[model samples]
Target: MKHVIALDVGGTGMKAALVGAEGELLYEARRETGRERGPEAVVEGILAFAAELRGYGIEHYGEPASAAGVAIPGVVDAEKGVAVFAANLGWENVPLRDLLTERLGGLPVALGHDVRTGGYAEGRLGAGRDADRFLFLALGTGIAGAIGIDGVIEPGAHGGAGEIGHVVVRPGGVPCGCGQRGCLERLASASAVTAAWSAATGDPRATAADCSRAVDAGDPRALAVWEEAVEALADGLLTAITLLDPRTLIIGGGLAEAGDTLFVPLRAAVASRITFQQLPSIVPATLKDTAGCLGAALLAWDLLDTEVRA
Candidate 1:
């Protein structure tokens, strides 16, 4: 069986897995990104991770991987394999693809944006499996989105199409880390939820999980904060639905773990606003945190198939 090494690089950690052609994981490993250091150190960490995976593949499977794929955050030029800029990681115009290829002796390599890859996996095998058009919203430490249509993932010009997090859900409400006021990330992201709840209740120790627990126990403040987040998210989704008319809207990332607490109100809010447009299904991401890795491996497999066709 031909094996591929898939790497999903996040702001906090990097997840790696050995995936077969059939989308099965044979082995996996991950490490903290140590992003506070710098970009070169991050690249060195990735190389070291890949080297360790190479050793594991050689020892356990009796050979090296057929190819490798990597998914990264920020603005990624997948066709060029360059991360144009990653503000969190302190990287700009980094040639990650060529760097990895040189380190791995020129084996085939594929690079992609983290959310786009996650959307690809969802469209192909998860929540959007049957939908011709769908949107993937990731609400983790930060917020972003990905769009898929007709079984094709459109990365848009400059590879930054589906960034709905900066949609200004609340005008002049709260400042965001992205140097903007009232971006959706500042209102509805996991961190934002925690901060908003803390600020509203004057409890400095409150967290997003705490807010969810309070909502479960019928705490009015927590419920109000959570409801505001859901409404902002709904407003953003309304615009997306009007434009794309996606058949499904997949919610992924840490905040999505709230389960029904997040989905129930979200669907209701969307339904309330969406009268004339087609109402889409709001579902949790099936692959969870591993979607990026799986989709990266799938991109490598696509490259393999393309080579065969050529």
Candidate 2:
């Protein structure tokens, strides 16, 4: 059976799959990125991993992978197939697409920003599949967004568009790594919540999930921290709604896994803050952690379609 390679490269690990033409995952695998070994090592690891997947496809499916797609973290220049910069991975202007193509014996390859790819999958195949316009927010260690329009995620000029995390929500509040104060991620992300809860509980290992449990138990301190996060998140989302007017808003990532603990209050807060902006249906992402891998598959399929049309 013919298949394509889909890879999602994160800071610490990579998720990959062999996807069939019908969008089914034929095979899946995971590997460590070994980022601590430096940028060059990471690149070599990616190349090796892609090559291995290609070989596995050939051996098991009796056909080589026709194409490949890679979703990577950081500022990516998708048009040029370059990974612009990834602070966590220590990458700078890496020609990842070209390297992968060459390593995979010239198979066509598509590279994209990780979050944008995930949003694209959500727009085309997940929560926002039916919406003409949507915004996908991932509230993990850090917050990031993807803007989907007419079933496609817009990468924006310079590939820096969906940086909703950096939006100033607190003004003079917390200091951000981007040299800003009170950024949305500083207050609303899972990491931020974990830090606050940990500080409050005097337990260095306390996590956001712990806070959720505390809130469920009616702990006043946990409720206070959770409410603060919800308020900041609502404020940031309101700013996005005012600017984009998306039809649906999809929330995913670790914090989103809190289920009603996060969404019930979040929906109410967002609703209360809205004045004239059309209220968007706030929903959870269905694809979960697999979104990025599936999204990479979509990119690979798109590359094949583009080639056929050309």
Candidate 3:
């Protein structure tokens, strides 16, 4: 079977894997990005990770892979293989594709936005696979989304689309890092949920995970905080549904890990908001943290296959 190396670069770490064309991971590894060292250092870390995957591929498949796919958190110029901007990683206009190509000895490389790749994986092989139209919403430290329409993941102009978190949820509520007050992220993101609970109870120690656990344990403060987040998230989903009318809403990232603690109330809130409109079924992501890596691999496969045909 043909194989490709896939890497998902995040602010904290990088996940690398050698994957078969059939989506089976042959080998995987993880390493910290050490992002504080700057963009070149982060790129070096990725190259090293890819080199390890190359070594693993040679050990198992008898030859190093000729293609690689990498997903990075931020606005990625997929057509140019440039990471346009990564606020968390403090990068700007990095020509990652050219560097990866040189490092991999002229091998083909596919670069993409991290969230878009995750949505691509879900649309092709995970929870959103069966839907002709779907939304991949990830509520992590911040919130973002990806739109999958008819099996095509739309990255939009400049590859910065699907930033649903920037949408205003409250008119004059909490301020957001993006210079907006009451943005969806301010009310519904993991950080926001934790902050809300913390402020509500004057407990600086309270966190989103703690609030989730509290909600699970019937803590009223946790319940109230979670309820507010769920309601805000539902409002955002309601707006997305009205516009995109997706068939499925795939929820992923750290916040979604709360399972029923997050989903039950979220689903109900969504149900309560819709009257004449159709409500998309909400489901958790199946690929978890690996979705971006797998999707990057798929992108690599697609790019290489297209080149071969050309």
Candidate 4:
């Protein structure tokens, strides 16, 4: 009946769960990140959320949680257990792991980058489970990626590796918040497609989902928008494939919900672009939004193991 608390803190909301030793989810919950209120408020919200989950585990299992894990966006120093920076949350250099451990009565807490942590789940339990090497991409409002090797997500030397979204595919095309022009996310992410589709149809509210439906209906304008995004994505992915040579490519996040609409053309586009690089299996992710929580649990469990070994 032992369990750990898992939390995935996103820009707008947080997903949490109580996970057993065998990776079974005992309970799940969600909360607004309260980012609009301010960074300090957001930190307090996360602490409160983790405390509540810990309380639930104690009440149900008659013991406190063994450990806790959290995944947050932006720059994170996992080794230092500090959330270095998160633009969406307006946070900088917050000692999140220390804060959580203090809140949970000294329970060990692991902090990770959201995309990389989610890819850890996908690598071990989802589409990348069988691959020795894989790249997991989350095509959300903004694209992000994780590189997995030998069942582990590589944190890279500085912990900023696997940032495929920042790969420049369209030189001098569009400006990115990261201070780059023609970054992959600006050209190929869900938000990019939404912007393109909205401008094309003169509907300010048109979304990437709407574009997908229109593509299904054989709308030429939607086809144009989708194709543009697909082509840019292919260009970016080709760079990853060339550099990483992964055996599998797992696609997740909101835009990935398009399923075949995104996959079929994407596969063809990548195939057409690749010459010397071996084409990796382009597959859709199975965990959806829950991957982050599951991965956070994995981190918590890993932390417990490391503690026992030490």
Instruction: Report, for every candidate in turn, its global Cα lDDT versus the true structure.
Output: 0.90, 0.95, 0.90, 0.95
| RMSD (CA, Å), each prediction | 1.3, 0.7, 1.3, 0.6
- Candidates 3 and 4, the one with greater lDDT: 4
Query: lDDT: which is higher, 1 or 4?
Result: 4
lDDT, candidate 4, at 200: 99
> Lowest-lDDT window of 10 residues in candidate 4?
169-178
**lDDT for model 4:** 0.95
The sequence of per-residue lDDT tens digits that candidate 3 reaches over residues 1-310 is 4699999999999988888989998888899999989878988988878877887788889988969999998888899888898999989999999988888888899998888899999999999989999999989989989999998898776577789999898988887878888899888999899888889879999889999998889999888889889999999999998888889999998899999999998999999999878988999999998898899999999998899899
Residue 6 alpha-carbon offset, candidate 1, angstroms: 0.5
Per-residue C-alpha lDDT of model 1 across residues 89-125, encoded as one tens digit per residue: 9999999999988887777889999988988998998
Model 4 misplaced regions, further than 4 Å? none
Each prediction's TM-score versus the true structure? 0.96, 0.99, 0.96, 0.99
Candidate 1, which segments miss by more than 4 Å at Cα?
Answer: none
The lowest-lDDT stretch of 10 consecutive residues in candidate 3 is: 152-161
